[model samples]
Target chain A: MIARLRDGLAVYFCLLRGALAARMTDRADLGISMIIMLLADLVVPLTTLLVYQHGAGFTGWQRDEALLLQATFLIAKGIAFPFCFGMIWTTTELVREGTFELLLLKPRSTLLLLLGHSFQPEDTGKLLGGIALFCLALPNVTIGADADSSAALLGFAALLLLAVLTLFGFALLMTCLSFVWIGNSRLQEIFDAVSAFALYPHGIFTRSALGWLTWVIPVSVLGYLPASVLLGRPDPALPLAVGGALCFVLVVIGLWRMMLARYASAGG
Target chain B: MNRLLAAWRSTCAIAYATYQEWAAYRSHMLISLFIGPTYFLVQVVIWQALLADGGTIGGYDRTALMSYYGAVLIVSTLVFDFADWNLQMLIRSGKFLTVLLRPMSHRGFALSQKLGHRCLGLWMEALPIWLILWLVFSIRLVPASTGWFVLSLALGFLIMFLVNYCVGTLAFWLTRTAGARRLIGFLRDVCAGVFLPLALFPHELQQLLFFLPFQFITYVPVQVLLGHYELAGIRLGIPEIVGCQALMALLMWGLSELLWRLGIRRFSAAGA
Candidate 1:
């Protein structure tokens, strides 16, 4: 078991190193790309400042808490973007150009290979921006200085993992759709609208709307739940919401397999 | 005069062909039908959440904000520029040589295609948008005159085209600019008040933004539709702001032309 685990680790690192090496050749382009995406990361904090200065915020959340929610989102975006958020586009191009056959020839899992092969280090700018926002908002957020605070922070950290997983799951689902529907990039556009909607506080939504985004769409899992956990005001529906997201991921993986099965290589 | 007439004829022919190309599609038409209204609804919902009591937020009361955004839904949609994405692709794929191989300038072709797309968009999107705004939001264009509003819309289109065209021309020097275009395009959309009223911005910042051409893209035209725009803390009536926007649009058009001339000389097909 130890040897097998070590072999898997070796394979993963090999693929990751290859991706990093390819990106390092174009240092200038990578820097510029990161700066460009970082500009988008900066917009949320700016808007939060504007909204709160107007003396209104989402019902239960204060301005600083809203900023924290946005930071959680940006951090997840930054991590997922570098690992797999961009796979939807990469997979579409690969399938369209008939190069996906090369990916299947690899002995490793195709999805794992896709994850490593499409790393976008340029998204680290978003990570930097998120960290900056988190630091700026931390002083203003109302966290108690007690042992319960440590437990809450730990809970918040776990929810952050859940947010990243949900985000990556969404990207994987989109990538699967690209395999099934070659040249139909329009379906990918809806991801933009869905994500843009996800940045708001959960309070802005009604109970029904909240349930829908949480259970049906899992958009709330992207940012709101983690932020809510940190604020010590997690909804009574937390377990159902998290279970719904896990079930959604399971559904997405099943769909992904079906899509992969349907894909007949253009090269063949 | 003969040369000018030939150019005009070429533009019209391309416009006709492109219009037919787009009109053949039903799915894209359906998508266009939703894009404007969906974007407008996002703004409406967010603003509604923030403005819970329905009193003034910045300088805009709730009704005024609704009217501004309602007009925004129409005008911003009409003036949308989709050239930068296509231009970057053409350059990166070495398809731009096809334009140089042809007799007409690339800029002319780009503008003609845009006009065709927007023409179809108008037929499908404009009337439905007005109905939705009127029925749902009770919004109307309260311009000083129909003539000035129409002029403002035309100039806004020209301004949008010029701003995007300038970015598109950067493909001549850059390796691939799709990423740059998306980021800059988002920045433009946000700064131009697609997602919120620029009037909601503090007055000093608004005054500073007034000097930038980005404000002319959507803010000035919407203000013209609303019959007044504030500049330097002075409220300018519709005619004055429209006059200012006309000059800015003309200036951007000239600058885009100059940039295109400079950029084409740097264009190298073999390396691309």
Candidate 2:
């Protein structure tokens, strides 16, 4: 098992089995950790739940609708975290300690190996919390029974995957930023500062601010757009949103490859 | 008395070193300086959306709401403590040995370092952020009394530092406390009203929060700044709030010191 962990190029199942075994060795400990994270995930929604109940909610969202949006954000974050978002810190540490070069030299795909190494299985608790909240709020929300409802649900699932990919691209950018700013990198914190806006409904923001989030940072891809599909809203920009997300994924992937190539030649 | 004086002098030297260390990284710290302003901007937009029809949120009008958000940024930055993360890094890197060999307690060293770091932050981040909020958003900070405002804020710094100090000492038992610290930090941010004003919470929840020292960190100081303390029935004025905060800080310090003492025993046994 240890050897499997040391060798990232080992079979995918072998890597996952080794990780599961190690994490399962202390099941109670793992459970406690997950519970702690789940509680943390609940805090923001709980606060917002109280705030809405107290009679102040966003422009287009009441208590239940706001909960749905918050749950959407959490679900996306939870899914993205274990696979991609958490790796931002891992890559930053690697670049800082000069071991990132060693990672590049590995036989397998570097990004895949990074993902395996940085997998945070405990973050599933976040996903579970989001699902629980979504379930509680779903019935309170009305969805059209027409053919568009099925299409919107499918779109919600597909767009959810793209949203996670969009976040991965941002993480890739932050990794490159870490390389440029060797000692201290608050680039990720800037991402976080911007991401706080994602917690609220998009209608709360000005048109220009929404435009910026949609195109520049694309944070709405993480929550608002996905929730729109779930709510069966006839989004005129559905095609635009999908095309923009795909283009962003391509651009960041290209940038990540370029950065990797530069690291190969520069050696520093 | 002589030994206490010596330890005090040594801590002062450590604080000076920490201040210089942070000063050298000022440019890197600029990102954090911008976080407050960015966060306040988001709050302004959100409240604007909520109050578009010109309604109050938990008794706060639009201008009052903006000022409260601005006040929160100032206080949260002022009282921010990273002892938990710092301790985790020190322990992970095996540099905690240097701390163990010192005559003074790690809490004292960490607290002194925090003090010097925040003293710089007061000028570098907090004040400038306040000025920007005022100039850009026209969010006026109308403190009922400067004496109480400063007093509450100073006490808040001590209380938050001690809470974080207790959390940091848990590193002795846990190998990696990044997640734990982050969770605690998140709770503190929420419970302390950094995310939203505590007034916006339900009355029952707000009453429950009064018992937790987290409220003293950002909410109390902000309340004093907004003159909401008088509205909350703080009839005794500046001295009473100052005294209450000092009492909370003392209690937290005692509890944290007890934990540290016990934790160090476990740590020494583990040769960590």
Candidate 3:
């Protein structure tokens, strides 16, 4: 499995490089896409900081801690970007245009093939922004600098990767809804709308009934729960992060397999 | 006067025809209805959370925030224009030539058609949600001052329409206005207090955003409806909100018309 995964990663990178090469011909679009992405990354955190400092401090987390949550969101978006962002919309077009059939004849799983084909080169900027924000925000966590706790930090990093995987799984689930709701672009718009809710600090929703939504939907887990755990906030429910990730993986794989059986390929 | 009346009547007829075309897609309309409500519900949930801690944000309490967001959902749906998207498509497909040969003014036809679509769309999707919120949430209204609210909303609509037209006109030169649209949308969402109350923005940013036109389209009308302005009962304060909205509306409308003329001239010269 590890070998296959490595091979898949190698193939994915090669395909991504090809896409980047193709995108380079359209340098103007690439430049605009980069600027938009940089602006998106900058605006969210800045808006949060402005809103919190002006209105009231965040309910559960301080400014630096909230920035960490924002960083987690950017990182999750970065991880999902290379794989999901381009494919979600393009998949609908493929299905509508009956071009998806060309994808199924490939040697690999169609999911992996689609994932490899749909890389957005501009998201590299987003990924770098996420890392920069994470690094900048990292120092604000008051955890003592002890060499022994490096293991816990490593564990946390692993959990963060799991969180990204879960987010991708969920995004895939939303995109796959297009297969079921064919010809209705409103589903895509609705997904965009719901995803907008994830842009803010999840601690804002602490006592509301929709707080369950943050956990069950794992929108907050993409940022809030992992950030909270890493910041060493006392929460007995920290283990749920691992559980959510596992469930997300299992459910997403299960759903994709089920849908794969029903996918009638659009002629390429 | 008769000519103007006839033009208005013909415009209304075209609008009705467009509405009928939209109505033909029942499944699409139903899906839109479902999506619209769900989107508003999510906004409500977010605002509820923001106000959950019983803390004041920008001097807005929980109920006030709910009323503001609920009003925004309704007002935005009502005033929203899709002419930008339409303009982009027209420019890309070179459909403006067809409009240029028509008897009526292109801008007039485009604006009226959008107005008709908005009216039809609101009746189909937004009105029910607005009524439900009003009844269920006891959303406060600026009663006996219906004129003030209506006039403010009109100004808001004009601002929204002009801004969309201006942004869409950029497509003539830029080839693709999606980037501009996205940036505009982001700015609008933040500054117009669509996601949260604009008051929550830092005083500096809020002041800066006041110079930008997005606030006129969404925030002001919502504020008017929620009776945020210092007006005593039974007194009309249309001038305050309406004045600002009218000024911005005129500025944006003038700028958009200028751009549209220049853009069309460029396209004509290029034979695009």
Candidate 3 differs from the real structure by a C-alpha RMSD in angstroms, to one decimal, of 4.1
Model 2 misplaced regions, further than 4 Å: A1-13, A16-32, A145-147, A264-268, B1-8, B88-97, B172-179, B230-236, B269-272
Residues A41-85 of candidate 3: C-alpha lDDT, one tens digit per residue: 766677567656756555666777778877877887787776676
lDDT of 3 by residue, B1-272 (tens): 99989998988988888788777655655665556666666656555655567876667777776777778877888787878888877886888778788998777787888777777768776676777676766664443367777888888888888888888888888866666776776667667777667776656777687777888888888878776552112233556766877889989988987998798877862235
Q: What's the ranking of the predictions by DockQ, best on top?
A: 2, 1, 3
Best by lDDT: 1
- Candidate 2 chain A minimal-lDDT segment of 10 residues: A259-268
Winning candidate number (DockQ): 2
Check candidate 3 and list the clashing pairs.
A98-A266, A98-A267, A99-A266, A99-A267, A101-A266
Looking at model 2, the pairs that clash are none
True contacts kept of each: 0.23, 0.47, 0.28
Per-residue lDDT value at B38 in model 3: 63
Give the CA lDDT, 0 to 100, for residue A44 in model 3: 61
Report how far residue B67 has shifted in candidate 1, in Å: 3.3
Candidate 2 docking classification = acceptable
Which residues of candidate 1, in runs, are more than 4 Å off?
A: A1-11, A144-147, A265-268, B22-29, B32-39, B124-146, B178-183
Against the reference, the lDDT scores of all candidates come to 0.79, 0.77, 0.71
Q: Which parts of model 3 have CA positions greater than 4 angstroms off?
A: A1-15, A41-44, A144-149, A192-211, A264-268, B24-55, B131-144, B202-208, B230-236, B268-271
lDDT of 2 by residue, A134-187 (tens): 898888986533547778788788878887788788777776666666656567
- Model 1 residue A121 CA deviation (Å) reads 1.6
Fnat of candidate 2, please? 0.47
